[model samples]
Target: MDFEKLLVWQRAKALAVSLYKELANCGDVAFKSQITRSGLSVPSNIAEGMERFTNTEKRRFLSIAKASCGELRTQIMIGGEIGYIPALLADRWINETREISKMLSGLINRISD
Candidate 1:
């Protein structure tokens, strides 16, 4: 399947872009990079995984992508707690990541089965 065409991917990509903007102003360089990297990684990994040569490979990458989504979730929570990210913004990304994670899980299950 073309993950690029998937609504989940599309939403994740938009979320990533918004996240990029959100983290850019964060004063801590390392924190911003780490969070942004993992945030961007979620959808990118999903796209790359879909293009893999085997379903096993796809599953592996998708799992990592799901992990990245989880990482993004944690980072957002931490950011909000630390006052780096606002509650509303954090909630938006959290919701987007949760949905994307669910979609990625469904894709992985279908590929595995």
Candidate 2:
């Protein structure tokens, strides 16, 4: 299946785009870069994994994507605490990361079986 067709991938991509837009004018370059990179990694790794020929490779990439979800969630929390991200928006994004992580887990389990 194409990664683009996956709901998780689509959501992940959307979240990353939202992050970029929200942080466009952020004064702290380092924080913006770190958060955006983690957000982007979710969909990017998912796409890369789905395109791999082997299940092992696919799982590896999916696992990386799952890990990125956690990383993104952490960054989001930190961003919120540090006043970089708005409260509501940060909560929404954190929830999204959790859902995306669950979706990635499902995909990994399916591939494993």
Candidate 3:
């Protein structure tokens, strides 16, 4: 199956694209870079995992992607509190990360089985 066809991958890619566009004008370079990297990691890892030859390899990459979701969520919360991100946008991204994490978990479980 193509990774791009997966809903989780599509949503994850969209989230990363949104972050990059939204933070394009951010003044804090470090914060912007960190958040965007983590956001990008989710879909990147998912695609990499799906391309792997073995289920174990796929699960490992999916797990890493799931962890990246948590990392991105934390950054979003801090960015929102620090005014780097708008309250509503932060909330939406946070929810998206949560959903992405859940989807990754489902993929990992399916791979395991």
Query: RMSD in angstroms, all models?
Result: 1.2, 0.8, 0.8
Pairs with steric clashes in candidate 2:
none
- All candidates' lDDT scores? 0.87, 0.95, 0.96
Which lDDT tens digits does candidate 3 get at residues 1-100? 8999999999999999999999999999999999999999999999999999999999999999999999999999999999999999999999999999
Write one digit per residue (lDDT tens) for candidate 1, span 1-113: 78888776788788889988867777899999999999889889989888898989999999999999999999999998899999998888788888889988898898963
Order by lDDT, highest first: 3, 2, 1
Candidate 2 has its poorest 10 consecutive residues by lDDT at: 104-113
Q: In model 3, state the lDDT of residue 56.
A: 94
lDDT of 3: 0.96
Worst 10 residues of 3 by lDDT: 104-113
In candidate 1, list every pair of residues with a backbone clash. Answer: none
